[model samples]
Target: MTQDLFDPFAPVPETPAKSGNTPEFSVSDLSNALKNTVEDAFSFVRVRGEISGFKRASSGHMYLALKDDKAVLDGVCWRGQAGKLGLVPEDGMEVIVTGRLTTFPGRSKYQIVIETMEVAGEGALLKLLEERKKKLAGEGLFDADRKKPIPFLPDVIGIVTSPTGAVIRDIMHRLRDRFPRRVLLWPVLVQGNGAAEQVAEAVRGFNDLLPYGHIPRPDVLIVARGGGSLEDLWAFNEEVVARAVAESDIPVISAVGHETDTTLIDFVSDLRAPTPTGAAEKAVPVRGDLIGQIEENGLRLSQAVRRLGVEKKTALESLARGLGDPKRMLEERNQMLDNWADRLPRSAVNVVSQARARLNETSARLVSPREQLSEKRGRLENAAVRLDGAMKSALQMQQARLDRASAGLRPSDAKRDVDRAGKQIMDLGARMGAAVKNTLTREAEGLARYDRLLESYSYRNVLKRGFAVVRDGAGNLVEKSADIVTGQGYDLEMGDGVTRVTAGDATTEPASTPTAPTSGGARDGDDMPVDAVASSKPETVSKPKAVKKKDPQPKDDDRQGSLL
Candidate 1:
């Protein structure tokens, strides 16, 4: 029994085999068969699923996996078809794809060859839009600080919209109504199939225009389109379009769809208009209103200037009132000139007398020329005697030295030394004479200056300027009005001659003040005759009151007065 136990590796006895009819297939042939079957069965199908593992190849083909929770079906969108699909497919996007089912023999896999694709529903489109917004916002593309300010008045306006749509017509009509401006139309597809790419390219093209070239660069850009559904307006919401709007150097005004409709470009643009017409309104101001405002401002400025002039004139008039009468001021200045004139003659006489006294004193201190010459002659005689004695002694010493040095001494050298000494003496005498002449000339110039100064200080100059001196009976100056006594005789010293006149009684009180009337005379403020007033005070003479004088020719109020 142990020997008969299982032999695991032993060969078993063979039996005759019978075969039935069945089909055989290679890997290539089987894969081809299945592909054809799938193509025929689901040739035109719309499959709804969330996209996964989405990839765009360099060959311009898109490969993606369409997946629900339970299963995934591979899908491919050729380059030509992918662009026709309005929206780009992204991972996690719920989409409906219309295509034929096919199999790849190389990988032995089945896939959907996508002809067209779209967001599965409104909810899916909104979700995709929101997700993309969040992603771009996180990158700071929607930041308010990144947005440029719109120009109040743009020179050239660039519009990106469909060429034949009512949106452009509406914008142009609105602009014409408000203000006329140069409009550059960058025609683009506003919706469907490659619309987003066209919009992006149009924006970039407008920005690329040279500012000072054949084409004028736009100061502002308007991306406008008519009202439509979210899907129809999705071209403006694409990330490519949004990014182009954000990076534009010119300010962008987004006006897409209706007022309630929103897009990603609207967030990144400098301004968002509710409608295409609204965008035009934002681009320029009402011309008539601007002209009216300018005219109003000009009127206001003129009024302000006139008012300022009136105020300054009033201020000047008030200041002029504070200044005393100009005639009285001139009289006072003339009196001052008279006083200066009276002192000038005396000052000049004193200066001349002092200078003359100094000259006499200096002359008294000087020695006589004859005595000076005699003293100098005695000194010269003494010097000559000393020289004679010194010369004799020096000659004796030289004779002793000559006995030893005459062997090498030259008579020609001695003669040359003597000639040089004589030449030096002549030069010194000439210089001394020139120095004395210069000193005399300087002293004469100084004397001339003093003489001119004395003449300048003379009172005759003051008299020539129409000033006169007033002196009392005692020949003392009556320098002020208070110094003149009633019935006193005084001398008026003019430049040519002097006249004597008795001073009349002077008024002590101001003209504006009232004085008590004399006994049996008219009361104050009474306009009585001058002769009658004099007759009333027969014993005592009454001086006329000094009235404040008014300007005879008043200055024009419009003329600017001198500050001085």
Candidate 2:
């Protein structure tokens, strides 16, 4: 190797002498000095170390340190912004933390903010039981009351686990041995970050997809995973996983982790099994045992039916034996029985003949009454029919007679009715007239009789008793006997309208003096003075005028005429 400043294959280098510092430089040049020089100087930093200190804050911030036999470097995490560290940082944990070199200005310290923290070999299994407990408890998944009861026998089953995992294989094997039936598998992640959501989705989907009625709605379910650390089984403790188990209508059999490892799903499940195989066994009855039991029950049912049949037959046989028939014992007596039977037929014939004789006698006796009854019935029926015809004819004749009578009596009855009414009116009028006449006559007769009695009885006594009469100058009868006019023309009516009397004169027997004239016409005896005519004549009657006739003209006219 020749020591030369220039390369034959490239341009020679130019040297610049050191000069005083200039007040000029590009920001890129200074940045480039730090970036490139620091990058080149600290590039490929091989950190062969052991983890000394570790911290995980409640804020999910990780703080740690890396140290070798000589020196140590501080490491920090800015919350959860990366994948999980391969190993937990504890004292004496071999690791290699890879990251870009950076400086902290607070103390101007250079450190490595870990982009990756890898442990050399296997560190330790994360036995985060407290965290697991807290996670499961926070979900309230360990409540026993939330557990559903597993169906005694399921027609359909749903298994949520890895399809290729031994868990499914074990369950299938155990189920075949127990129930020997097909099981539905929903392949899902069971050991990673998405394990809880995947397993929960599978459980919910089976429940959501279940059919109606009991035609076997995925009757039981199993959530399973192989054994691992708490982190490996942590997905089952998530709220999604726990609530999935709790919300299942079908019974959930939680088969996760080792038997010693407990999970939140195990508490909330209807039944918990140590392994997936155990869960399958718990879910179904052994098919062989079930078959045996069914066969035994069928045998017992057949035996019971046969026993009942035998008992019924025996009872029937006993009943038959108890009914003794005489025909069964009539062996040697066949001929005698036949003869007796023949005699029976002959005796029965004789009895029948006697019965027939009695029946004939009774029949003969009843025949007379029956015949008489029949004749009477026939006569009664004939009479009834004849009576009906006669009644009809009589009704028709009576109807015709009534019509004829109505027709004949119409005009005569009308005339008689009018006549009767007229007669009634005439009778009423005659009665009224007669009543009036009778009343008038009775009153007149009463008056006349009374007057006649008064005159005949009273005047007879007055005249017979020599009651004398006197006159006034005017020829008026003197009511009192003190009236004294010697001579005046006057009329003296005794009991009758006639009387004989003498005349008295004043001086001598005077002749009939003539009356003097006045304004009135000359009246015969009316104007004659008493002194003038002292003498007068009295009238004499030939026959007594019976029952005086009243003048048609008024008597007052005569008086007035005399005055005039």
Q: Estimate each model's TM-score.
A: 0.53, 0.40
lDDT of each: 0.79, 0.64
Q: Model 2: residues >4 Å from true position, as ranges?
A: 1-140, 212-217, 326-564
Per-residue C-alpha lDDT of model 1 across residues 1-564, encoded as one tens digit per residue: 122212332222243333453234456655665666677778999999999999999999999999998999999999999877888889999999899998888988889999998888888889889999999999999898998889888889999999997999999999998889999999999998899999999999999999966999999999999999988999988999999999999999999989999998999999999999999999999988998999999999999999999999999999999997999999999999999999999999999999999999999999999999999999999999999999999999999898888688889999999999999999999999999999999999999999887654555433333234567788776655556665667666544666676655335433212212212233232242345334434422243422111111112222112100
lDDT of 2 by residue, 449-470 (tens): 9988655444332323222233
lDDT of 2: 0.64
What lDDT score goes with residue 200 in model 1?
96
Tell me the lDDT of model 1 at 504. 52
Measured with C-alpha atoms, the lDDT of residue 298 in candidate 1 is 100
